[model samples]
Target: MNWSGWSIDRVLILFVSLAYLVIGIQVTMFHYRQNFTHKAMWIPVISSPIFLIAGLILTWYNAPWVHTMFMAFMWFGALAGLIGFYFHFRGVGIRVGGWAMRNFLIGPPVALPLMFSALSVLGLIAIYWKVR
Candidate 1:
């Protein structure tokens, strides 16, 4: 979709939905295996909100004031995911070396930089569109 003219509400909804999907996957993994170390599980839990914050800041930097509001809403949703992650991790001890950790180790090296770059590009586009 053309995110430039998209309302903040829509963007927030979309971001939240994505966050939910990620959290849901994590929960499902936990349910199926029931054997993740707290440390492994907490990586995504902690980093997810940080990712949202980064996205929000990028949005604010690039988009209009109205869009910034939506970014805030998205951030809130991400915060909820963080809380859920915290609770899940609290109950479950560290699983040490496992799928989660393996992914964690690999994800940042690959996915994170790509995600940041994509957000950066999106922010630039938002800014360009706003200025135009």
Candidate 2:
């Protein structure tokens, strides 16, 4: 690829979009193992594609509508991740060991949800930050 007029924010948005794709796959597999016991498990799986597509569209056109849609999804993803963190932490507490390190290690990934939120924040920064 020729390096020409790609701004840093544009590149960062695309990178975040790709990261969503990877994380989506991982989430899907993890949920599948649990048989997707609850519908909430599908939230991140579905939203991942929304963010990825909107972000990729922004990279191509970046129309005002696209920007708004992408920004909305980013915010949704951020909130969902936060909620997921709480749920995952509760899962560990409810497990056999009851909040022990072993339960945290084996019950649910307590930090993965925070990672999801961090990625969404990165995308938001890319979209909202004014490069000077």
Candidate that would win on TM-score: 2
Most accurate candidate by lDDT: 2
* Residue 130 displacement (Å), model 1: 20
lDDT score of model 2? 0.88
Each model's TM-score? 0.30, 0.96
> What stretches of model 1 exceed 4 Å from their correct place?
35-132
Candidate 2: list runs displaced more than 4 Å: none
Q: Write the per-residue lDDT of candidate 2 for residues 6-103, one digit (tens) a residue.
A: 89899989999999998888888887888888788899888888888888899889899988888888898899999999988998898886989989
Cα RMSD for predicted model 2: 1.0
Tens-digit lDDT track for model 1 on 1-132?
Answer: 566896654465346435544654554455346454434544444544554555555434545664555455444433444454454443333345433756555322333323433433343343334421
Clashing pairs for predicted structure model 2, backbone only: none
RMSD from true fold, candidate 1? 9.5
What's the TM for model 2?
0.96
What C-alpha RMSD separates each model from the true structure?
A: 9.5, 1.0
Model 1 worst lDDT window (10 residues) = 107-116
Query: Local distance difference test, per candidate?
Result: 0.45, 0.88
